[model samples]
Target: MRILLTGSVVATCAFMLFTSGRTLAHDYKLGPLAINHPWSRATPGGSKTGSGYLRVANTGAEPDRLTGGSSPLAERITVHASSTDNEVARMRPVVGGLGLTPGQTVELKPGGAYHLMFEGLRAPLKANDKVPATLTFEKAGSVEVVFDVAAMGAGEGAAKHDGMAPGMHQNGPFQ
Candidate 1:
Protein backbone atom coordinates (compact mmCIF):
# COMPACT_ATOMS: atom_id res chain seq x y z
CA MET A 1 0.00 0.00 0.00
CA ARG A 2 2.81 2.40 0.87
CA ILE A 3 4.58 1.64 -2.39
CA LEU A 4 1.38 2.26 -4.30
CA LEU A 5 0.91 5.59 -2.57
CA THR A 6 4.45 6.63 -3.42
CA GLY A 7 3.96 5.72 -7.03
CA SER A 8 0.77 7.71 -7.18
CA VAL A 9 2.49 10.74 -5.76
CA VAL A 10 5.26 10.49 -8.26
CA ALA A 11 2.80 10.24 -11.10
CA THR A 12 0.90 13.27 -9.91
CA CYS A 13 4.09 15.27 -9.70
CA ALA A 14 5.03 14.29 -13.21
CA PHE A 15 1.64 15.30 -14.48
CA MET A 16 1.93 18.71 -12.90
CA LEU A 17 5.35 19.32 -14.36
CA PHE A 18 4.13 18.32 -17.77
CA THR A 19 1.06 20.52 -17.52
CA SER A 20 3.04 23.59 -16.50
CA GLY A 21 4.52 25.11 -19.68
CA ARG A 22 7.23 26.92 -17.78
CA THR A 23 10.00 24.38 -17.95
CA LEU A 24 11.86 26.12 -20.74
CA ALA A 25 12.75 29.77 -21.01
CA HIS A 26 12.03 31.47 -24.33
CA ASP A 27 13.62 34.49 -25.97
CA TYR A 28 13.10 36.61 -29.05
CA LYS A 29 14.82 39.36 -30.96
CA LEU A 30 13.68 42.25 -33.15
CA GLY A 31 16.11 44.80 -34.44
CA PRO A 32 18.21 45.54 -31.39
CA LEU A 33 15.61 44.53 -28.82
CA ALA A 34 15.95 41.26 -26.99
CA ILE A 35 12.86 39.89 -25.29
CA ASN A 36 13.40 37.10 -22.83
CA HIS A 37 10.98 34.67 -21.23
CA PRO A 38 7.63 36.09 -22.27
CA TRP A 39 4.99 34.45 -20.12
CA SER A 40 1.55 34.84 -18.63
CA ARG A 41 -0.35 33.38 -15.70
CA ALA A 42 -3.26 31.03 -16.14
CA THR A 43 -6.60 32.73 -15.78
CA PRO A 44 -9.67 31.47 -14.01
CA GLY A 45 -12.89 30.70 -15.79
CA GLY A 46 -14.95 33.70 -16.91
CA SER A 47 -11.98 36.01 -16.67
CA LYS A 48 -12.18 38.69 -19.30
CA THR A 49 -8.65 39.95 -18.83
CA GLY A 50 -5.15 38.62 -18.09
CA SER A 51 -1.56 39.84 -17.74
CA GLY A 52 1.79 39.24 -19.48
CA TYR A 53 5.36 39.59 -18.27
CA LEU A 54 8.84 39.55 -19.75
CA ARG A 55 12.29 41.08 -19.85
CA VAL A 56 13.47 43.44 -22.58
CA ALA A 57 16.95 44.69 -23.30
CA ASN A 58 18.17 47.24 -25.79
CA THR A 59 21.50 46.34 -27.31
CA GLY A 60 21.81 49.05 -29.92
CA ALA A 61 22.83 52.67 -29.93
CA GLU A 62 19.39 54.10 -30.61
CA PRO A 63 16.42 54.18 -28.27
CA ASP A 64 13.14 52.48 -29.03
CA ARG A 65 9.64 52.29 -27.68
CA LEU A 66 7.34 49.36 -27.16
CA THR A 67 4.35 50.75 -28.94
CA GLY A 68 1.87 47.93 -28.46
CA GLY A 69 1.16 44.25 -29.02
CA SER A 70 -1.52 41.74 -30.00
CA SER A 71 -2.68 38.23 -29.26
CA PRO A 72 -5.56 36.03 -30.33
CA LEU A 73 -6.39 35.39 -26.72
CA ALA A 74 -7.34 39.04 -26.17
CA GLU A 75 -8.99 41.57 -28.35
CA ARG A 76 -6.57 44.27 -27.22
CA ILE A 77 -3.28 44.27 -25.41
CA THR A 78 -1.92 47.42 -23.78
CA VAL A 79 0.92 48.43 -21.57
CA HIS A 80 0.21 49.64 -18.04
CA ALA A 81 2.15 50.95 -15.12
CA SER A 82 1.50 49.92 -11.54
CA SER A 83 2.52 52.08 -8.65
CA THR A 84 1.95 52.69 -4.95
CA ASP A 85 1.38 56.13 -3.57
CA ASN A 86 0.30 57.11 -0.08
CA GLU A 87 -0.24 53.45 0.67
CA VAL A 88 -2.71 53.24 -2.17
CA ALA A 89 -2.04 50.99 -5.15
CA ARG A 90 -3.07 52.04 -8.60
CA MET A 91 -2.76 50.84 -12.16
CA ARG A 92 -3.11 52.92 -15.26
CA PRO A 93 -2.47 52.69 -18.96
CA VAL A 94 0.90 53.90 -20.06
CA VAL A 95 0.52 56.76 -22.47
CA GLY A 96 2.49 56.59 -25.73
CA GLY A 97 4.75 53.54 -25.14
CA LEU A 98 7.44 52.05 -22.99
CA GLY A 99 10.92 53.20 -23.88
CA LEU A 100 14.15 51.27 -23.94
CA THR A 101 17.40 53.15 -24.33
CA PRO A 102 20.74 51.91 -25.41
CA GLY A 103 22.19 49.45 -22.93
CA GLN A 104 19.00 49.60 -20.88
CA THR A 105 16.91 46.70 -19.66
CA VAL A 106 13.31 46.77 -18.56
CA GLU A 107 11.48 43.96 -16.88
CA LEU A 108 7.77 43.43 -17.01
CA LYS A 109 7.30 41.00 -14.19
CA PRO A 110 4.67 40.27 -11.61
CA GLY A 111 4.70 42.82 -8.79
CA GLY A 112 6.85 45.02 -10.97
CA ALA A 113 6.36 48.51 -12.37
CA TYR A 114 5.08 47.52 -15.80
CA HIS A 115 3.01 44.77 -17.39
CA LEU A 116 0.91 43.93 -20.42
CA MET A 117 -2.84 43.88 -19.94
CA PHE A 118 -4.90 41.59 -22.09
CA GLU A 119 -8.37 42.91 -22.50
CA GLY A 120 -11.44 41.16 -23.85
CA LEU A 121 -10.20 37.62 -23.51
CA ARG A 122 -12.08 35.24 -25.72
CA ALA A 123 -11.32 32.17 -23.62
CA PRO A 124 -9.63 31.12 -20.48
CA LEU A 125 -5.92 30.41 -20.57
CA LYS A 126 -5.02 27.05 -19.12
CA ALA A 127 -1.75 25.69 -17.92
CA ASN A 128 0.61 24.50 -20.67
CA ASP A 129 -1.16 26.71 -23.15
CA LYS A 130 0.91 28.83 -25.49
CA VAL A 131 -0.45 32.22 -26.45
CA PRO A 132 1.03 33.63 -29.62
CA ALA A 133 1.62 37.36 -29.52
CA THR A 134 3.22 40.08 -31.58
CA LEU A 135 5.11 42.86 -29.84
CA THR A 136 5.34 46.06 -31.81
CA PHE A 137 8.05 48.59 -31.29
CA GLU A 138 8.84 52.00 -32.60
CA LYS A 139 12.09 50.95 -34.21
CA ALA A 140 11.97 47.18 -34.02
CA GLY A 141 8.67 47.03 -35.90
CA SER A 142 7.25 43.78 -34.47
CA VAL A 143 8.20 40.26 -33.52
CA GLU A 144 6.06 37.21 -32.97
CA VAL A 145 6.55 35.23 -29.81
CA VAL A 146 4.81 32.61 -27.72
CA PHE A 147 3.79 33.29 -24.19
CA ASP A 148 4.04 30.17 -22.05
CA VAL A 149 1.15 30.10 -19.63
CA ALA A 150 2.11 29.22 -16.11
CA ALA A 151 -0.08 28.11 -13.22
CA MET A 152 -2.21 30.86 -11.77
CA GLY A 153 -0.11 33.00 -9.45
CA ALA A 154 2.90 31.20 -10.79
CA GLY A 155 5.56 33.69 -11.94
CA GLU A 156 8.77 35.24 -10.84
CA GLY A 157 7.87 37.18 -7.69
CA ALA A 158 4.29 35.94 -8.08
CA ALA A 159 2.51 35.44 -4.81
CA LYS A 160 0.55 32.29 -4.16
CA HIS A 161 -2.81 32.62 -5.81
CA ASP A 162 -5.65 33.11 -3.34
CA GLY A 163 -8.47 33.19 -5.82
CA MET A 164 -8.55 36.90 -6.32
CA ALA A 165 -10.13 38.21 -9.47
CA PRO A 166 -7.85 39.14 -12.35
CA GLY A 167 -6.24 42.47 -11.52
CA MET A 168 -3.09 44.09 -10.18
CA HIS A 169 -2.35 45.55 -6.77
CA GLN A 170 0.74 46.78 -5.03
CA ASN A 171 1.06 44.08 -2.44
CA GLY A 172 0.18 40.83 -4.18
CA PRO A 173 0.52 38.78 -7.31
CA PHE A 174 -1.61 39.75 -10.30
CA GLN A 175 -4.83 37.79 -9.89
Candidate 2:
Protein backbone atom coordinates (compact mmCIF):
# COMPACT_ATOMS: atom_id res chain seq x y z
CA MET A 1 0.00 0.00 0.00
CA ARG A 2 2.87 2.37 0.77
CA ILE A 3 4.47 1.62 -2.56
CA LEU A 4 1.23 2.38 -4.41
CA LEU A 5 0.83 5.67 -2.54
CA THR A 6 4.39 6.69 -3.42
CA GLY A 7 3.81 5.93 -7.11
CA SER A 8 0.62 8.00 -7.16
CA VAL A 9 2.39 10.93 -5.56
CA VAL A 10 5.17 10.71 -8.10
CA ALA A 11 2.69 10.68 -10.96
CA THR A 12 0.89 13.73 -9.63
CA CYS A 13 4.16 15.61 -9.27
CA ALA A 14 5.14 14.75 -12.83
CA PHE A 15 1.84 15.99 -14.19
CA MET A 16 2.15 19.27 -12.31
CA LEU A 17 5.62 19.82 -13.62
CA PHE A 18 4.49 19.24 -17.21
CA THR A 19 1.57 21.62 -16.91
CA SER A 20 3.68 24.31 -15.26
CA GLY A 21 6.25 24.13 -17.99
CA ARG A 22 3.59 24.76 -20.58
CA THR A 23 2.14 27.61 -18.55
CA LEU A 24 5.54 29.33 -18.44
CA ALA A 25 6.48 28.58 -22.01
CA HIS A 26 6.93 32.23 -22.87
CA ASP A 27 9.91 32.65 -20.57
CA TYR A 28 13.25 30.91 -20.84
CA LYS A 29 16.85 31.18 -19.82
CA LEU A 30 20.03 29.78 -21.29
CA GLY A 31 23.62 30.46 -20.47
CA PRO A 32 23.96 34.16 -19.73
CA LEU A 33 20.73 35.17 -21.43
CA ALA A 34 17.33 35.58 -19.86
CA ILE A 35 14.55 35.58 -22.44
CA ASN A 36 11.24 37.06 -21.42
CA HIS A 37 7.80 37.23 -22.90
CA PRO A 38 8.40 35.94 -26.39
CA TRP A 39 5.23 36.77 -28.22
CA SER A 40 3.64 37.51 -31.60
CA ARG A 41 0.60 39.28 -32.88
CA ALA A 42 -2.26 37.35 -34.42
CA THR A 43 -2.14 37.34 -38.18
CA PRO A 44 -5.03 38.55 -40.24
CA GLY A 45 -6.98 36.19 -42.43
CA GLY A 46 -5.16 35.27 -45.64
CA SER A 47 -1.99 36.85 -44.38
CA LYS A 48 1.11 34.84 -45.02
CA THR A 49 3.48 36.83 -42.85
CA GLY A 50 3.87 37.60 -39.15
CA SER A 51 6.35 39.12 -36.72
CA GLY A 52 7.72 38.06 -33.32
CA TYR A 53 8.92 40.12 -30.39
CA LEU A 54 10.92 39.40 -27.28
CA ARG A 55 13.36 40.77 -24.73
CA VAL A 56 16.81 39.29 -24.30
CA ALA A 57 18.88 40.30 -21.31
CA ASN A 58 22.56 39.62 -21.20
CA THR A 59 24.07 39.22 -17.76
CA GLY A 60 27.48 37.93 -18.74
CA ALA A 61 30.64 39.82 -19.42
CA GLU A 62 30.80 38.82 -23.06
CA PRO A 63 28.48 39.97 -25.82
CA ASP A 64 26.51 37.79 -28.18
CA ARG A 65 24.74 38.00 -31.53
CA LEU A 66 21.41 36.69 -32.60
CA THR A 67 22.30 34.96 -35.81
CA GLY A 68 19.08 33.43 -37.05
CA GLY A 69 15.98 31.49 -36.12
CA SER A 70 13.59 28.88 -37.51
CA SER A 71 10.00 27.95 -36.99
CA PRO A 72 7.94 25.06 -38.28
CA LEU A 73 5.08 27.44 -38.94
CA ALA A 74 7.06 29.58 -41.37
CA GLU A 75 9.04 28.64 -44.42
CA ARG A 76 11.67 31.26 -43.60
CA ILE A 77 12.54 33.29 -40.57
CA THR A 78 14.91 36.25 -40.60
CA VAL A 79 15.92 38.97 -38.24
CA HIS A 80 15.18 42.45 -39.52
CA ALA A 81 15.31 46.09 -38.56
CA SER A 82 13.08 48.94 -39.67
CA SER A 83 13.81 52.58 -40.40
CA THR A 84 12.11 55.63 -41.81
CA ASP A 85 13.64 57.89 -44.40
CA ASN A 86 11.87 61.08 -45.37
CA GLU A 87 8.51 59.75 -44.20
CA VAL A 88 9.06 56.50 -46.06
CA ALA A 89 9.42 53.37 -43.97
CA ARG A 90 11.57 50.50 -45.07
CA MET A 91 12.80 47.28 -43.53
CA ARG A 92 15.99 45.51 -44.31
CA PRO A 93 17.23 42.14 -43.28
CA VAL A 94 19.84 42.39 -40.58
CA VAL A 95 22.92 41.55 -42.58
CA GLY A 96 24.96 39.62 -40.03
CA GLY A 97 23.00 39.39 -36.78
CA LEU A 98 21.49 41.40 -34.01
CA GLY A 99 24.04 42.21 -31.37
CA LEU A 100 23.51 41.82 -27.65
CA THR A 101 25.89 43.79 -25.51
CA PRO A 102 27.12 42.58 -22.20
CA GLY A 103 24.98 43.68 -19.28
CA GLN A 104 22.48 45.23 -21.60
CA THR A 105 18.93 44.33 -22.53
CA VAL A 106 17.77 44.08 -26.13
CA GLU A 107 14.14 44.27 -27.00
CA LEU A 108 12.72 43.01 -30.27
CA LYS A 109 9.59 45.02 -30.69
CA PRO A 110 7.33 46.79 -33.20
CA GLY A 111 7.49 50.27 -34.75
CA GLY A 112 10.95 50.79 -36.11
CA ALA A 113 12.98 48.25 -34.18
CA TYR A 114 14.46 44.81 -34.30
CA HIS A 115 12.03 41.92 -34.85
CA LEU A 116 11.77 38.47 -36.31
CA MET A 117 10.21 38.42 -39.75
CA PHE A 118 8.33 35.26 -40.47
CA GLU A 119 7.53 34.64 -44.12
CA GLY A 120 5.39 31.96 -45.72
CA LEU A 121 3.42 31.18 -42.61
CA ARG A 122 1.77 27.78 -42.83
CA ALA A 123 -1.40 29.08 -41.25
CA PRO A 124 -2.80 32.22 -39.75
CA LEU A 125 -1.74 32.71 -36.13
CA LYS A 126 -4.79 32.97 -33.91
CA ALA A 127 -5.09 34.55 -30.48
CA ASN A 128 -3.75 32.43 -27.60
CA ASP A 129 -1.89 30.19 -30.02
CA LYS A 130 1.66 29.17 -29.27
CA VAL A 131 4.29 29.10 -32.00
CA PRO A 132 7.50 27.27 -31.40
CA ALA A 133 10.74 28.75 -32.72
CA THR A 134 14.42 28.07 -32.40
CA LEU A 135 16.82 30.99 -32.05
CA THR A 136 20.51 30.61 -32.83
CA PHE A 137 22.91 32.90 -31.05
CA GLU A 138 26.58 33.50 -31.53
CA LYS A 139 27.89 32.55 -28.12
CA ALA A 140 24.95 31.05 -26.32
CA GLY A 141 24.14 28.65 -29.15
CA SER A 142 20.56 27.75 -30.05
CA VAL A 143 17.50 27.70 -27.82
CA GLU A 144 13.93 26.71 -28.58
CA VAL A 145 11.30 29.22 -27.53
CA VAL A 146 7.54 29.44 -27.68
CA PHE A 147 5.89 32.66 -28.82
CA ASP A 148 2.54 33.51 -27.29
CA VAL A 149 0.03 34.84 -29.80
CA ALA A 150 -1.59 38.14 -28.90
CA ALA A 151 -4.62 39.76 -30.42
CA MET A 152 -4.52 41.17 -33.91
CA GLY A 153 -2.97 44.65 -34.07
CA ALA A 154 -1.34 44.15 -30.69
CA GLY A 155 1.80 46.20 -30.34
CA GLU A 156 4.50 45.02 -27.98
CA GLY A 157 5.81 48.46 -27.17
CA ALA A 158 4.09 51.81 -26.77
CA ALA A 159 2.91 51.98 -30.36
CA LYS A 160 -0.82 52.41 -30.89
CA HIS A 161 -3.04 51.53 -33.86
CA ASP A 162 -6.63 52.59 -34.35
CA GLY A 163 -7.86 49.80 -36.57
CA MET A 164 -6.33 51.05 -39.78
CA ALA A 165 -7.25 49.35 -43.00
CA PRO A 166 -5.36 46.24 -43.86
CA GLY A 167 -2.58 46.49 -46.52
CA MET A 168 -2.35 50.18 -45.79
CA HIS A 169 1.37 49.78 -45.21
CA GLN A 170 0.85 51.00 -41.71
CA ASN A 171 2.78 48.49 -39.60
CA GLY A 172 5.05 45.48 -39.95
CA PRO A 173 8.41 45.33 -41.67
CA PHE A 174 7.06 47.59 -44.40
CA GLN A 175 5.19 50.70 -43.47
Candidate 3:
Protein backbone atom coordinates (compact mmCIF):
# COMPACT_ATOMS: atom_id res chain seq x y z
CA MET A 1 0.00 0.00 0.00
CA ARG A 2 2.84 2.40 0.85
CA ILE A 3 4.60 1.78 -2.47
CA LEU A 4 1.37 2.30 -4.41
CA LEU A 5 0.76 5.64 -2.67
CA THR A 6 4.28 6.83 -3.43
CA GLY A 7 3.93 5.90 -7.09
CA SER A 8 0.63 7.71 -7.42
CA VAL A 9 2.12 10.85 -5.85
CA VAL A 10 5.05 10.78 -8.27
CA ALA A 11 2.72 10.41 -11.23
CA THR A 12 0.61 13.36 -10.08
CA CYS A 13 3.66 15.54 -9.67
CA ALA A 14 4.96 14.63 -13.10
CA PHE A 15 1.63 15.40 -14.70
CA MET A 16 1.47 18.80 -13.04
CA LEU A 17 4.98 19.67 -14.19
CA PHE A 18 4.22 18.79 -17.78
CA THR A 19 0.98 20.77 -17.85
CA SER A 20 2.50 23.81 -16.16
CA GLY A 21 5.37 23.95 -18.59
CA ARG A 22 2.98 23.94 -21.53
CA THR A 23 0.98 26.78 -19.99
CA LEU A 24 4.06 28.89 -19.41
CA ALA A 25 5.26 28.38 -22.97
CA HIS A 26 2.78 30.90 -24.36
CA ASP A 27 3.12 33.54 -21.66
CA TYR A 28 6.13 35.12 -20.00
CA LYS A 29 6.64 37.30 -16.96
CA LEU A 30 9.56 39.49 -16.01
CA GLY A 31 9.62 41.61 -12.91
CA PRO A 32 6.48 43.77 -13.08
CA LEU A 33 5.75 43.07 -16.73
CA ALA A 34 3.54 40.29 -18.02
CA ILE A 35 3.82 39.47 -21.72
CA ASN A 36 0.89 37.56 -23.17
CA HIS A 37 0.39 35.91 -26.54
CA PRO A 38 3.48 36.91 -28.39
CA TRP A 39 2.47 35.95 -31.87
CA SER A 40 3.10 36.62 -35.55
CA ARG A 41 1.49 36.01 -38.91
CA ALA A 42 2.73 33.48 -41.40
CA THR A 43 4.64 35.05 -44.26
CA PRO A 44 4.19 34.10 -47.84
CA GLY A 45 6.89 32.61 -50.01
CA GLY A 46 9.64 34.94 -51.29
CA SER A 47 8.99 37.31 -48.40
CA LYS A 48 12.10 38.31 -46.53
CA THR A 49 10.39 40.09 -43.64
CA GLY A 50 7.75 39.41 -41.05
CA SER A 51 6.01 41.06 -38.10
CA GLY A 52 5.32 40.12 -34.48
CA TYR A 53 2.79 41.32 -31.95
CA LEU A 54 2.10 40.98 -28.24
CA ARG A 55 0.64 42.65 -25.19
CA VAL A 56 2.75 44.00 -22.35
CA ALA A 57 1.15 44.93 -19.06
CA ASN A 58 3.08 46.93 -16.51
CA THR A 59 1.97 46.31 -12.96
CA GLY A 60 4.73 48.17 -11.18
CA ALA A 61 4.68 51.77 -10.06
CA GLU A 62 7.46 52.65 -12.46
CA PRO A 63 7.30 52.63 -16.23
CA ASP A 64 9.46 50.74 -18.71
CA ARG A 65 10.42 50.92 -22.36
CA LEU A 66 10.64 48.12 -24.91
CA THR A 67 13.94 48.97 -26.48
CA GLY A 68 14.73 46.19 -28.92
CA GLY A 69 15.03 42.44 -29.35
CA SER A 70 16.63 39.56 -31.26
CA SER A 71 15.52 36.34 -32.90
CA PRO A 72 17.38 33.39 -34.36
CA LEU A 73 14.88 33.29 -37.24
CA ALA A 74 15.79 36.80 -38.36
CA GLU A 75 18.95 38.75 -38.91
CA ARG A 76 17.66 41.66 -36.82
CA ILE A 77 14.51 42.65 -34.97
CA THR A 78 13.39 46.21 -34.32
CA VAL A 79 10.35 47.95 -32.93
CA HIS A 80 8.15 49.68 -35.51
CA ALA A 81 4.89 51.58 -35.78
CA SER A 82 2.59 52.16 -38.74
CA SER A 83 0.67 55.29 -39.47
CA THR A 84 -1.34 56.93 -42.21
CA ASP A 85 -1.68 60.51 -43.34
CA ASN A 86 -3.87 61.80 -46.14
CA GLU A 87 -4.62 58.21 -47.13
CA VAL A 88 -0.96 57.35 -47.51
CA ALA A 89 0.34 54.63 -45.21
CA ARG A 90 3.81 54.60 -43.80
CA MET A 91 5.91 52.70 -41.29
CA ARG A 92 8.88 53.74 -39.24
CA PRO A 93 11.06 52.42 -36.46
CA VAL A 94 10.07 53.46 -32.98
CA VAL A 95 12.88 55.79 -32.09
CA GLY A 96 14.13 55.46 -28.51
CA GLY A 97 11.85 52.41 -28.19
CA LEU A 98 8.23 52.15 -27.16
CA GLY A 99 7.24 53.54 -23.80
CA LEU A 100 5.21 51.56 -21.29
CA THR A 101 3.46 53.66 -18.68
CA PRO A 102 2.79 52.45 -15.19
CA GLY A 103 -0.40 50.47 -14.81
CA GLN A 104 -0.93 50.71 -18.53
CA THR A 105 -1.15 47.93 -21.07
CA VAL A 106 0.60 48.29 -24.43
CA GLU A 107 -0.46 46.01 -27.22
CA LEU A 108 1.50 45.34 -30.37
CA LYS A 109 -1.02 44.28 -32.91
CA PRO A 110 -1.39 44.20 -36.67
CA GLY A 111 -2.25 47.24 -38.76
CA GLY A 112 -1.42 50.76 -37.60
CA ALA A 113 0.16 50.10 -34.24
CA TYR A 114 3.41 49.21 -32.53
CA HIS A 115 4.80 45.92 -33.83
CA LEU A 116 8.05 44.08 -34.35
CA MET A 117 9.84 44.27 -37.69
CA PHE A 118 11.87 41.17 -38.46
CA GLU A 119 14.38 41.75 -41.22
CA GLY A 120 16.18 39.09 -43.19
CA LEU A 121 14.06 36.16 -42.18
CA ARG A 122 15.89 32.87 -42.36
CA ALA A 123 12.80 31.25 -43.86
CA PRO A 124 9.12 31.79 -44.27
CA LEU A 125 7.26 31.77 -40.97
CA LYS A 126 4.61 29.11 -41.41
CA ALA A 127 1.39 28.81 -39.48
CA ASN A 128 1.72 27.07 -36.10
CA ASP A 129 5.50 27.53 -36.05
CA LYS A 130 6.99 29.02 -32.91
CA VAL A 131 9.48 31.86 -33.22
CA PRO A 132 11.73 32.43 -30.24
CA ALA A 133 12.55 36.04 -29.42
CA THR A 134 14.20 38.01 -26.65
CA LEU A 135 12.67 41.34 -25.69
CA THR A 136 14.78 44.01 -23.99
CA PHE A 137 13.08 46.45 -21.69
CA GLU A 138 14.37 49.53 -20.01
CA LYS A 139 13.56 48.44 -16.49
CA ALA A 140 12.74 44.77 -16.80
CA GLY A 141 15.94 44.04 -18.71
CA SER A 142 15.64 41.10 -21.09
CA VAL A 143 13.12 38.26 -21.19
CA GLU A 144 12.89 35.41 -23.66
CA VAL A 145 9.52 34.57 -25.15
CA VAL A 146 8.12 32.45 -27.97
CA PHE A 147 5.85 34.00 -30.58
CA ASP A 148 3.22 31.68 -31.96
CA VAL A 149 2.74 31.94 -35.70
CA ALA A 150 -0.88 32.59 -36.54
CA ALA A 151 -2.57 32.42 -39.93
CA MET A 152 -1.39 34.94 -42.46
CA GLY A 153 -2.93 38.43 -42.06
CA ALA A 154 -4.21 37.92 -38.52
CA GLY A 155 -4.72 41.07 -36.46
CA GLU A 156 -6.71 42.62 -33.69
CA GLY A 157 -10.37 43.44 -34.37
CA ALA A 158 -11.08 43.39 -38.13
CA ALA A 159 -8.52 41.34 -40.06
CA LYS A 160 -7.87 43.84 -42.82
CA HIS A 161 -4.32 44.12 -44.15
CA ASP A 162 -3.74 47.78 -43.53
CA GLY A 163 -0.53 49.68 -44.25
CA MET A 164 0.96 46.72 -46.07
CA ALA A 165 0.71 47.98 -49.61
CA PRO A 166 2.18 45.82 -52.31
CA GLY A 167 5.85 46.70 -52.79
CA MET A 168 5.63 49.51 -50.29
CA HIS A 169 9.14 50.49 -49.29
CA GLN A 170 8.32 52.38 -46.14
CA ASN A 171 9.63 49.92 -43.54
CA GLY A 172 12.78 51.91 -42.87
CA PRO A 173 16.09 50.15 -43.47
CA PHE A 174 14.50 46.76 -43.97
CA GLN A 175 13.23 47.76 -47.37
TM-score against truth, every candidate? 0.75, 0.74, 0.75
Backbone collision count in every prediction? 1, 0, 0
lDDT of 2 by residue, 1-175 (tens): 3555588799877776665554355456789987766788999988998998887888889999987788999987788998999999899899889998988887788884788888899999999888999988989999998888889888654222223222121222111
**Candidate 2 global CA lDDT score:** 0.77
Model 1 residue runs over 4 Å out of place are 1-25, 157-175
* Model 3, span 1-175: residue lDDT tens: 3555588799877776665554456557799987766788999987999998877888889989998799999988889999998999889999989999888887788875788988899999999798998999988999998888888877563221223222221222111
Sort all candidates by lDDT, best to worst: 1, 3, 2
Candidate 1's TM-score: 0.75
lDDT of 1 by residue, 32-65 (tens): 8877667899999999999999878898999999
Local error of candidate 2 at residue 67 (angstroms): 1.3
- Candidate 3 wrongly placed segments (more than 4 Å): 1-23, 157-175
CA lDDT of every candidate: 0.78, 0.77, 0.78
Largest TM-score belongs to which candidate?
3
